[model samples]
Target: MQSWLDMLREARAQGRRFARVRVVTLPLNDYSRFGVWCSQFTNGAGEDIRYLERGKAAALALPDHDYWLFDSRKLVRMHFDDRDAFLGGEVIEDAAEIVKHNYWRDAAWHHAIRRDDLATEQHLGRV
Candidate 1:
């Protein structure tokens, strides 16, 4: 986590934009709670992180897949194993697919709550 934060810090220092939106289910699990705890530092390093409840995201018809969209031009769709372990990703260069990912990213970002706010709510047992 510190390694990623270091990279993010450097990227922000270089004027690069960094953001993440995590879709979490209600009754947060241990892993999810840990992530929220770590976000305190990452968010402080200039990474704009947000959270959206799974139910809310489902109502919006968002896919349950995760991917990284680079510069609005490239995408690498993530593939996970049955146990939700990271396997690998397929780099997608198709214009249509890239457009879809960009659109989703924009929509999710628009609706997701900031990490700081979510963390506070979670810590207070209101999430």
Candidate 2:
């Protein structure tokens, strides 16, 4: 976690932006709550994290899985098991695929609420 925070800080120093939209469920499972707690540290380190309730995200028809879009150039599709354990990631450099991920990123970012704002509004940080 320290390494991740350091990376985020370094990226910010280099004027690079790091952002993510976390889709969370209504009931807030233990894992989701833990993620919310962890986001505070990451957010402080310069990552722009946002939260979107599952229902709202469903309307956007975002991918059922997770991914990382870097600089609107490369896409890393994340794979997980049925139990939600991380398996691995597939790096995709195809222009068309990257473009699609970029569009998803934009749509999610537009509808998601900033981490701090959502925490305050939903009293999530208290969890």
Write candidate 2's Cα lDDT for 1-127 as tens digits. Answer: 9999999999899999999999989777888778888899998999988988888889989887899988889899999999989999999988898998899889999999887777777677544
lDDT of 2 at 85: 94
Please list the residue runs of candidate 1 whose C-alpha ends up more than 4 Å from where it truly belongs after superposition. Answer: 124-127
- Per-residue lDDT of candidate 1, residues 6-117 (tens digit): 9999999999998889999867898999888777788888888899999988888888999998888989999999999999999998999899988888888888998778
Report every candidate's CA lDDT: 0.86, 0.88
TM-score of model 1 vs. true structure = 0.92
lDDT agreement of model 1 with the native:
0.86
TM-score of each: 0.92, 0.91
